[model samples]
Target: MLEVGSTLPEVSFGYIKDGKMTDPRTNEIFGDKRVVVFAVPGAFTPTCSQAHLPGYVALADKIKAKGVDTIVCLSVNDAYVMDAWGKASNAEEIMMLADGNGFFTKSIGMDMNTSDFGGTRSVRYSMLVEDGEVVKIFVEDPGRFEVSDAETMLKNL
Candidate 1:
């Protein structure tokens, strides 16, 4: 899995803006910036919707106060789903990034197969990336939401 000092892979996210598909390059979004990226297994899942993303949304101001330029919530779902979730969750302070095919998660070795969940998905994790390099990474254990919470990250920051 990616860790402190690892450079993020070149991944592209598919987004829909004005009824057109937009694939923004990873570097274009994170390059030369202090970005906080948190990953969840799914967009509408209980833990993710109830806590993970919401925690970040609530603390976005504080996080940015620490010099974070961007706050990204990335999932393996499509752009439409991600966008919808963002609106419902009041995530104006966060950027919703779609990894439609799990390319980004797999490339970073953060992919997992939870048979109970019925398919491949990303492991819940968050990272502090500065200038395209990882400086802090919080990876949650299976079925747990401990180290990866926003409060912990904010404290660390």
Candidate 2:
């Protein structure tokens, strides 16, 4: 796993803005900014939909108030699915990023082979990045959601 002080890997995550798909460079997103990146194993799954994402949604303002320039919620799903989820969850503050190809996840050494669940996916984790460098990271154990919750990250911040 990428540790604290490591520079974020160069990758592009699909972004859906104004119903148009765009590829946003990871470095540009994190450049000279304090950003929070949270990865989920899959979107709309039980723990993810009911708890994980909501925790962040509930605390988005608080996290940003602590100097976070942006908050990103990442999953292996594509741009369209992510857009629908962002709307369904009312997560206007979070930039739902689609790592459809898992390139970013693999680069960070967080990719998991969840072929049984359909395909490759990222493990649940979160990192606090400042100016494109990681300052803090929390990776959850399989089938768990403890340390990476928004409340936990907020406390750290």
How many clashes (backbone N, Cα, C below 3 Å) per candidate?
0, 0
| lDDT of each candidate versus the true structure | 0.90, 0.92
Using Cα atoms with residue i matched to residue i, what is each candidate's TM-score against the true structure? 0.95, 0.98
Model 2 C-alpha lDDT per residue in residues 78-141, reported as the tens digit of each score? 9898889989999999999999999989998999998898588999999999999999999998
Please identify model 2 stretches exceeding 4 Å from their true place: none
Q: Model 2: how far is 134 from its true place, Å?
A: 0.6
Cα error, candidate 1, residue 132 (Å): 0.7
Model 1 lDDT tens row, 47-80: 9999999999999999999999999999888999
For residue 2, model 2's alpha carbon misses the true position, in angstroms, by 0.5
- Candidate 1 global CA lDDT score: 0.90
| CA lDDT, candidate 2, residue 31 | 91
Best by TM-score: 2
What overall lDDT, based on C-alpha atoms, would model 2 receive against the true structure?
0.92
Q: Tell me which residue pairs clash in candidate 2.
A: none
